[model samples]
Target: MRHAGPKLLTQIAAVHFVSHVHIMLIPALLPVLPGLLGVGFIELGVALAVFNIISALVQAPLGYAVDHYGARRVLKAGLLLGSLSFLLLAASPGYALLLVTMALAGLANGVYHPADYALLAKGIEPGRLGRSFSLHTFAGFLGSAVTPAIFLGIAAVLGTRAALAAGAVFGAAALLLISIPGSGVYRVAEVGNKGCAGPVPATGRVRLFTPMIGVLTVLFILLNLSTSAIEKFSVAALVQGQGLTLTWANTGLTAFLLCSAAGVLCGGALADRTRRHGLVAAMAFALAAALTALVALGVLWDWALVGVLGAIGLLTGIIAPSRDMLVKAAAPPGAEGKTFGLVSTGFNIGGAIGPVVFGWLLDRGLPSGVFVASVVFMVLTVGLTLAQEVFMARKGRGALRYQR
Candidate 1:
């Protein structure tokens, strides 16, 4: 098989970055929108929800399309549609228009992971596939991390419309870059048989939907629930529930994000060295859960609070590459797009439900419940990871026995 090498990694990572930036653009502009559009925050919230729900509904089907049509074609369409969604946002004339625009954005966002992962699965060298996945994820996190500053800065200087227009420009540029020959994205058949990049059996009737896939999906949801709790509510919970200063609270959140980014880089290196991805995920989530549980105790103060939160971030970040590898291991041949697409829906599902669940706990004067719930979910993730390994091992043994 042709190895796409660094160029491909860079191209895919760039798209991942732009896609995340586009996804986050609306949220960054949210506070400004109510005044501009003459609507209430509740209405704005509903618009955002519509975008996410639509994206969730379409993710799996889009993944299937990636396998059928081609990753490059589907990915280009997603990029184009995502860019157009921003253009629509820039020109949105009313609340109804804004709602329609967000739905467009969701459709564009939904196809990304399936196509992106499919490309990586086929294009990247086997030894470095884990790092390739890491870079792809890291690019996304960087996009989210930078969106507030990038768009808000543009909005301040050039006006909101210009800022959104700038987003459209980014999508166009990504489309052109990936369209170039020697870019990482390839047609499915262009990939030669790279041995043991986690292959499924060839003889039997293949099934993409399996107990392992279901368990992996649930694992993704639970992991995101823990993360969303911290990302969305940790600051407020720290202030109101733990009586921490806003400065300290925000610092903890910031530390969590920064450390998590750093941990992703570290995890990539570890991923290249080992195939025991399930063990890596299990240990990381288990450690993260313990650190999160400490925060629930509310005994830490100031720096200690930030330190513990950072620890949780680090552990979870380390789990990411391993988690992706685990999913790749469980995938049936030629089903990369559909499998990733299906599992990634868990993120949207968890993200949709997490805020409400964690927010309710905070509203009810149970701040500790936020952390406690996160720990519970993380523990569940640990269990799922272990169970998935056992199941995969059994299947492997059964396949070998059948061959004999």
Candidate 2:
């Protein structure tokens, strides 16, 4: 088989990038949602939780769909439903309609990772898969960073309704681009018209659910929950609980996200350089945990807060590619979609719970609990990473050796 082309990478990355943008649109729009939806902050949080919970329930099935049917069909449907959800939002109906909208979006969002990763695995050269995975992750993070600017920036001038319309248009445009016949993602999907790739040698049907995969899944959950805690609650925690100004708090959050994107790039190069991805992830988590504990202690004030947040972001971001490498290393043969699908569910599970938990802490007048929770989760992730390393070693199926 020929090496996969750059077009495949771009197409898959584009799908990931667009899906993240849609996922983040709610957060960016949350400030104004209460006014529009006639609900309180907690109600808004519930809506977000509904989206995530639904996503968690469906992702594993979508993984099976990707293997049994085809990623192209699922991906195309995801893009369409994702767009429709925003259009429904633009319509600004009642709370019931909003819940339905989120459910549709959540179901659609679940298909992306399974589909995109499956496509990349089938298309990319083995030697370059790590970098491809990094680029894919980087695109998603970039999408997260940009969503606020796109949505809020537009809503500031135009109405929020117009902003939602624009988001819908964005998804529609992506769907059209990927649908084009000569495009890289399209060509690959066309190879198996039914959308399912031809059969490869089968491992056990349940092999994808190994203990190492479970550890990796938990690691993903902890990572997402920790990030969600920081992103959702840190600013308010700092301002209300720690006596920091809103400006400084927002600056810290921005530095964390921007530095994280930068770290993905660095991690991509580093992923290619070493096979000890488990060690790399462990070290990164340990440092991030320590820094987060400092944040929880309020040891850093003003400029120092921004500096510490940036450092934490960099350390955590650097682990991402290595983290992906570890999961790939643990997958049984021909189980790429199943493994990624299962592990990715951890993100939704965390997303489903993180906001409610952290928001409750803030509501109960426990701002310090936000950062404290982040540190605890990060520390737990470090333990899991080490355990995963030991498990893989004992199985004699070490990290990065399974790439082929």
Candidate 3:
């Protein structure tokens, strides 16, 4: 087989990029939901929980399909499912259908990531891995970054229903494009596609590195939960608890995501040099970042405060690619998706647990608990990282997750 080509990368990246655009529409809509639907925070929480819980449970099975059945089939099906699910959201005459649609959309959302990343891992040359992953991630972030503006514009010009309908149209277009003959990962993997080059002859010895895989999964889980905790509660804490305005609250949140984008770019470029050590550096940054977040809550953060929050976001992106590389290297044969699914499952668990606990603390009137919880989670993850490094060293890494 020949090497992978740029066209396929762009195609995969395009699908990934637009898919995020679809997801981000939900968050911006959250603020408007109460006025639009007469629902309160409890109902909104239920909506989000239902969507994510369904996603968490179904990821492993869908990922397993991506591993054995091929990404083409899974990707195409997910696209269709995703597009149709929005119609469910649009057609919902009641909360039950909304729940169903959101959960289905979540399931469809779960299908894309592991399959897409695993496909990239299999097809791309090793030297280009960091760039490929980073570009793909950046594409998604770029889509998300534009979401607020898009939502603001749509809500202003077309009204909520029409704007969302336009989004569904976008999803539908993606579904159609993904289904086109030789258009998606499946066809790219097909022989004679010229772009995807199908399966590479190279495969990593992953089973021997189970310990690394397990630890990495744990870290990803902790990281996702830690992030969700801050994102979910930080705004509410600032606005309601701390009495800051919504706009100011949002500025801090946006800073975090934007900085994360910067971190990923830097992390990707540095991977070839530091390899595993890049992750250690990222974790160290996260330690400092969590501390900063705690401090910011106690003090007043202004424009300069955005810089610190941005640094926190930067740590997430910088740390992520290294962890992804570890999982890619450690994935067992015919189990890339399942491996990712397991890791994603951990994310879901964190996603689920974090908000409830954080909200609980908030309801209890311990505004500091949210930041404290984030600190504790980060601390635990760092401890896990250090323990794994020490264990690997003493055992001579008796695992091959990283090279000497």
Candidate 4:
């Protein structure tokens, strides 16, 4: 089992990496896609929006499928479907086809969180689960970080179609790796009650809609909303609001992203050492909120802005593992798929909303509002985290009393 643990983690993490790469592929090649498809940028944007909307809508139902059908099987099918979507795009490039392929990819994209978390919950040992989850998240961040440079470079040298084909190949390679005979992927549906930390109700279906899960869903939304603001608009905020040059603004954003990735590894270790995952998340969010507020003040020097953004990134990244751990704790034994799926939808929701809100702020000549709004989301997330901890504690005590 010990030997199998790392192998399983590696395979699943690779698939997650591929998923992120696929998610970013079209966006990375946006410069050339509009020309190739003979469509305006608006159409391409709509395609991207279609991808996100479909992913958000389908994720919860797909989670149920992951629990009913085996996770490994569902995950493999997702990989195949995602890969084929890109392959078909590469083979037949047109405006309508692009939309169709992106929608297909979106449905395929919805499978990752539910299927991936379900497999990890069932396959990994409890002792190292936090680290496993962190590594998985780090892999995704790495993929998203690198996709633009790698795929754009491919497009520059070869063509946009070639880049799409390369992405398909990447997914296919991940699929093949996990589908191997001794890959250690979980082969059975996880319907047993062994994985739940607290007393599970008789009707497992109710677990997906519990108040704790509702809190988690909201937490996920606020978390993503905060981070998405930083990721999408911080550079603009620094440039426009603080009068920093574009180069320096971009430099600060890069620092934030890189430090956030490093923080995830550190966070995994911290999550393993303590069971107070909610407290860890709350503290991280609090510090992050404070830093973001300072950034919003627009009083820092350019170098100081970079440093502050880096600190914010590290603090926010530190929250990821603990955040996932909290969700894992809240999930009922066999309902990890639906629970994670339901919560993960919040990411898409937050992702969709953050850009529009921040973009509006920027359009209104309120660049500082980007950081200010992010701070607001972060503080709300801190409160939500503490509230969730209280709820979980009360629920645990009630379960203990019932057992006694």
- What TM-score do all the candidates reach, one by one? 0.94, 0.92, 0.85, 0.94
- lDDT values for all models: 0.85, 0.83, 0.69, 0.88
Error of 4 at 116 (Å): 0.6
For candidate 1, lDDT tens digit of each residue in 24-45? 8878987677766789989988
Which is the winner by TM-score between candidate 2 and candidate 3?
A: 2
Clashes of each: 1, 1, 2, 0
- Per-residue lDDT of candidate 4, residues 153-241 (tens digit): 99999999999999999999999998888566744225533453444334344547878888889999999999999998888888888
On lDDT, the stronger of 2 and 3 is 2
Instruction: Order candidates by TM-score, high to low.
Output: 4, 1, 2, 3
lDDT of 2 by residue, 1-404 (tens): 33447988887888888999888887898877777778887777677778888899988888877766667877888899999998987887567777887888889899998888877877777678778888999999998889988899888888778887888888898798788886787556322244235554443355677777888899999999877787778899999888999999999999998888888888888888888898888899899999999999988998899999999989988999898888777766566677788999999888877877897999999999999999989989988889877776766754456664
TM-score of 4: 0.94
lDDT of 2 at 373: 93
Candidate order, lDDT descending: 4, 1, 2, 3
Give residue 250's lDDT in candidate 2 (0 to 100): 97
Backbone-clash count (model 4):
0
Model 1, global lDDT: 0.85
In candidate 1, the residue pairs with backbone N, CA or C atoms under 3 Å apart (3 or more residues apart, or in different chains) clash, namely: 8-184
